[model samples]
Target: MPLTFIDIERQKNWRIVLFFLVLMALYLLAAALFFAALLPGPLSAEPRFWVFLVIAAALTASIHFWFSASNAVDTVVRRLNAQPPDLKDDVHRMFANIIQELHVVTGAKRNIRCAVIPSLSLNALAAADLKGNAVIAITEGLLSRLSRPQVEAVVAHEAHHILSGDCLETTVAASIFGTFSSAMEKVRYSSSNRLFASPAFLLAWVLLQLGYLVNLFISREREYRADAAAVRMTRNPLALAETLHFLSRGWRGAGFIGSGFEMLCIVNPVATTLDETEGFLPDLLSTHPPIKKRLEILLQMARVSITELDANAERRSGRKGTDAQERYFVMSPARLWQGPFTAGELDALPWLSPLTWVANGKGKTAERAWKDPLLNTIFLRRLAGDGRIESGFTCPVCKQPLVTAAYEGTQIVQCGFCAGTLVENGRIPRIIARTGRERPCTERLNALARSVLQQNQARNIYRKVAARGAGQVPLLPCPKCKNPMFRGFYSTAHLIEVDRCSNCGLTWFDQDELEMLQCLIENRLLPDITVAVKD
Candidate 1:
């Protein structure tokens, strides 16, 4: 290829193509010389022989290049997670800006994409699609270090890879050359002895080494092209240059891959251990172009002074009044995973059983109660079976005595004295939470409330009696509310007694009390719940 064109940013006048034409021709000549050396002597000067050799060598080179680049793409990709990104805010917006600018500056027809890795490692790379899926990934560290413009510049470069079809070239190369690289890795890893002398295979070994270096050279060329494309799009080369400078500076030893792949990223290899930047040869095959040269290109953009970005983050410290990320609580945590739907609504969801909602709801309830460190049904249920407590409970509302009824494997205490119901499931609906929001005198209620309280206190003492006697004295202390429990023969269960708590209106029952309570509620038993007529 002859010198056709080049678009230099420093002078926006004369467009020059074939800017790398000399380099290309020089590389072609070198390729020819190398092939002439590698092939057999008999066909050395033959035209048809040279032609066949050229085609074979070129084809092999193409496949090796494609596989190598593809494998590198795959390697870095496997190192990454391919999931929908939960992006950092600024980085997300920067990617958006990059896409927008790429379209505006270079008219990239495709959409830009991104993914996040939770790792705090400072690195980023672009991977071309073998199948033409141009995806650009930015790191969490990119967000932490680079300002909006710098990030935008990085994205623009990646987008440039997409826009200029560098991804196509790279993807092809990686797909072909990456296969050879995999074999290289197998040999490198499988060798038991640290070293192998290959005098007979010297040229093969050297070619293998050259293959590694060639892959790097391809990576370096793509980066330069991407860099130039990025500047062309952003018109802000300085930011990209500055971003690269700081990017490599902060990246120390982190991900431990062969440094051979370092040039594939926007910065140095994460494991880089050198400060020598001026030497071009040290970084000649380096994927990242020199920051100084890049900055020179960036100075072409209007001189913009660098201002220090704020590094001190406002972390959430659980102080009483400090501003923090605001949170919202739905009806339950189950709603969060099941997604903004009520427990009942969750029952009808596809691929989910109706019963699942129940378990998830219970788990959510337990989690909330445990986090709260307050009294709840779990503690209340602990007092259920002590003999001193009676089977019947009174509704705190109606003051009418209530009996236990099971609904769908759960117990509800329903008031006989009034039309009040306590589900005992810890869910007082909004109507309920608001209905009796006013704190009643914990000390008093009307006659109906009082009757219930009396039964409650009796139940507490009866539990104590039963726990202590185990069927003998029939009187004991209520471990639940720490109130006294005593024995009293209720007609429903004259055969046994249970414990109850007076202060907290809890009743204990012997195991059969549920049946006994049902009998009492059905008017089958004449318990000593004799009524006092109001005057």
Candidate 2:
């Protein structure tokens, strides 16, 4: 095993040459078979015919190889819709800084460009082409969620791949046949006809299968090598270990990242049983090793166990709550004083605001919540996240001015107090497309989603059987149009209750409803249609 970057073995260019030769052989065989089936004469016995076939196959292979490998970096960046890191943005700036730091540490071996994929998937990839262009692209979700050290570890891992020259070979391999395979997949899904029966489709499928054969040449051990190199560079095995753990539980771009690009990514975007298991066949077929094994190896290096790592993560994420010594009493909306509550508990109250009357303890003098320094931080944080811009519209529920807040890279008006959001109909698809592994679908949210779906399902059934409309519920006035909005399920398919104003083309999602809808769709949680209903 290489202990230093200088010790890493240089990739043999002959491997790429061999790959080209194999591609030519496949093309030649395919062409010969194709012509033999169509022509009646013994074409194989004719020397001139053989010569012409060889030249045709060689030309075709050369074109395919050059087209796929020449501009691979650009091809991949375009496919993922990656953009250069926004130097003005904090997170993007930090990512850019890290890439610069990587360059400095490596003595500027290669001027690797950096890009940010506008996806919410937690995956990063490195691509190097024959043009000597190399780029490291990370998803927005990963950059936002990972700490600086964790992000450094990920960048280092991808950088090592590029520096060691494996990235170029892998890019070429994925490009040659994988690109066509991915294109064919999209075509197959989009077409309504029997695309599988098409001769062109069959040929592409054959080539795609042959593309998988390239994985045989690309060793899974490269990932382990990259991981080791990253650790050597960062000198923080625990950070990478924690990141691997987080990624294992989070979404890794299953549907968003295209096929055949898995080998280039730090982790397989699409999880497979073969990827997580180890054996003779898996070793030969899988492009990545088991994440669990990787984690164990890293944890050993860090001198920590998985349990400790989990505990540390929980503490960092604030999942492990602690008992608060200082408590405050707050006046409820009903003009009654609520019992003493911790600051954390107070923050959870939707109605609690800076103007709300609060006391340090039972009989203490009541003052505005903001007067207390501890409670003021909550409001300050809220303002920082959701109060940057005040939208003209008011919240339908809170009757307070809505703030323009960023959600999934799009702007939406949200109530700072009630946390309700008002979004235009046109922006809904963009928001949903952007929502992915950024936030985990908690069990609480999942349970609420399932219950809501079941209730909506039952309600629909009752309305259909009784030949009556939905039961009357108090409708909130539309923020944009002051008219009462229609409250109903977002769709029959999703069944998440939402308020919509037909005149304004706006929708209101109360508190957690928007996240619930995103969770429902992300996990594909369906309503139990067989649920019993009572009149």
Candidate 3:
């Protein structure tokens, strides 16, 4: 058996630590320059004075920030826009359980705080402060998209970082870098044009540049070790390998999790537009190893060839028939039955939702085929729910299934087809309260809104959506009961309206409307739409 990551050579670890210390010295050198510029002529001229200044500054910063680890962890959690996982929520509960299991396996008694970023971006990362407060945060996409095994793989990887003290080092390095960055920014924009008078900013920039490569290299090595450690803990290298492949394939264009923190994440949070070719420059600069290389290593560890693994995965999913022989049908957006395509063909569709009605080879409806234990396991995983069984409820607009999702303290049903959300009965209060009570992440909300609007505009539905506000939209039947739903304003302050089932006490928010509602609540703004006047 190959040696586990935890038992890796100590000499290599010491070498990395030495490199980090060297980087720290360079940072102090840079800070010395900044102090020299800030001080008077004679004092600045004395090299001993500059050295003392840098030491004092470094000590002050380290003492101020490092002593209170909770504050550092809290700052990071807030920066990443993370919230504590609701233990009552199935997904959140499962995530918490995974961390607990990893802790038990590693014999780590330090309580690992768990949080979730309300992002659809598929990423997970670990962070720790000098005083030992540690946090593990995963995105909403990870819970919604990945399987339990995959989630465990991710959690286990993060656990390794925490256990091996990587997260502690990361936090300290980031703090040092951040201090320099703030100083640089202040000096760069200063009104005084004392040409090169403040070499501190210049020195800070140089330290950042030199440290970048070393940091990237060390981060990449840590990732490999984490991968190995996760595999050992999960006893499933294939799951981690598949996760890497899935994440690489699902790369949504960058700026999801924010930059400068990519080194801490399992995968680089910032998406690169550069077409990464087989080259040294990409590998050297990347904070994580190439996906292909990681996959290959995992496959080697699993003792399975690529072809074998692919075949095994298919067999495990119970998908055996060829495209020519099997007949799988799907309901089109027009409510027309379009089919006789094979499972492979059906899978090729870009917009396959759990709400999508699919028929098997025997012409059995998805509802009926879903009863089969074997078929349910395989097909449901490919669907939006990820094989986790959900209570059945149809989307009133698209006439598709809805999945239960826990938001804050309330449980709401989300339409897998239309991307709408339904809050039933007294749940609306909880939903509204959650939004109203908390301080909003204004920048995050704005970025999210901009991204959503850009996507809608790209689809040419921006005009139609804007016009939707001006017209008396026809009422649709309630998803819960077939009663006519009433359209009314969501709040007294906002002009935006939502559909509510009077009888069933259900409120329906259309696609992207939930986000808009949150924004309205955050900013206390009225409807942003303009009415089109006609002659």
Candidate 4:
């Protein structure tokens, strides 16, 4: 177990910096208003005063609600904390059983612990910095409502998280959240009346909106990674699917349940995108993908029959495989895309070169992408910049960074700061060459898209072929096969590492490793045509 107590203090400084920046900006705004009072008398009574007052009143209402919600923990802790921290009985023991099962199956470390909240809200989550220190928390609601398999399914998912180093990742995230939450409490809720009257209340509100948005982006990736890990560990994908099905119908609450972690209770608060008839925001602020999609993925992974499953997947995607046997590779976005690639290709992708002020990977990850282009605005900066990204590291064997590139798309890559892929093991080439028909990942992409879209999807969503720095791969452990990585020469030209895990059977690769793998397949089928074709 590692000491991963939330970095509560450091997080607070960030909140303080944000608070002061907001306060200073507001101070300057007030000073400008005072100076404006010295402006023409006619302008003084311009209805902007009324508008500002209205905004202040709205701010007061918002602050009041914020204050009220902050006390929720007192009630929750008072109720939940008083009970023995651990649940007793078959349901409580179920998590332990699941953890034990995972340890035996995955050879994961033991000493895992479990806690149950008395509520039957169908929620289960994991926390801790290391295997021995990890804690799995489940709602009493989930235990009462779900089947044994369903409960174990959720536990297995959490077990994979603990094994995959998510505990440490989350400990870090919690530190940030804890600091922000604490500072927010100090600035906006010291007293109900004082908070309502102060402009800092409104300022804090704005800051929270932004902070949560940023947090959601990071959190979602970890969730998917956890899901992928679970599938590998248990090979019981339907456990998760079954669990989610039960969860969507979990405890129904009256009225609006506020946003954020509370909303992320395994089962998310149901929301539909706003249309002309209903008022709702897009899913961008959402903490997780729609429950429907999550289940769809698990159900696919739980395929009792891979051939039938792949066929169904293909139909849903509305196209036969471009090649009889091929799967697309994986991707992770660059810091919003000055992209991570070998340095030599940087010149051709000028827009991709993080050199210009506008596109430089900056801000949230200065060490990752350098200074943010938006933050360092000089008129000429956007036009010419080399997106120097020294952070947001990726695995040397994968050459891909962890990222969330779109609201609907899975968190795949655009690039990374440091990346490596060992293809010497036969797995990379085999993974690329093999059709997921034998082992599909979330149903074929094309099949799912077409079924959902009610039309045939675009041609070859996967890239064709890719190369970097003289077309070479290094020797390392295979990301997919876990064997000594093998570098295979595809056709006569394309070469790639078998980038996948052998133990769990999940594949790993950056961007179009699939396409390069695919191109090799195609060139083998049509060797004469390829030489005739030009880039």
Candidate 1's C-alpha runs over 4 A off are 1-76, 86-105, 110-113, 129-131, 144-147, 165-182, 191-205, 215-232, 235-242, 252-260, 270-276, 279-283, 296-535
lDDT (10s digit) by residue, model 1, range 1-535: 1111123222221111221233233333334444554443543365887787667666655554445444544455565663335445655665655556655554344555565544556666666654455566666766656777777788777765555554544444344334444554565566544223322224435554554444433434556666776776666776776776566456532553234434445665553333224455545544455555565555556464333211211121234234432221233434544344443343334333211222222235413221221212222232352222323553332222345654334555543323234433142222223322332223222333344434644554565555543445535444333445644543333333335454654444443343333333333233345433223
Error of 4 at 505 (Å): 84
* Candidate 4 per-residue C-alpha lDDT over 115-172 given as tens digits, one digit per residue, 9 for 90 to 100: 6666545576555442235566677767766667767777766765565554434343
lDDT of 4 at 349: 44
Supply the TM-score for candidate 3.
0.52
* TM-scores of all candidate predictions against the true structure: 0.42, 0.58, 0.52, 0.37
Q: What is the lDDT of candidate 4?
A: 0.44
Which has the higher TM-score value, candidate number 2 or candidate number 3? 2
lDDT of 3 by residue, 374-490 (tens): 333444555454653355877776555668876665677886556788887687656656774444546766566555544433323444555555334668788878787887656
RMSD after CA superposition, every candidate: 13.9, 23.2, 22.4, 30.5
Best by lDDT: 2
lDDT of 4 at 257: 27
Off by over 4 Å in 3: 1-13, 16-20, 36-52, 64-71, 186-200, 216-219, 271-285, 303-535
lDDT of 2 at 67: 82
lDDT of 1 at 400: 27
Q: How does model 1 fare in lDDT?
A: 0.46
Off by over 4 Å in 2: 9-14, 27-54, 186-204, 319-535
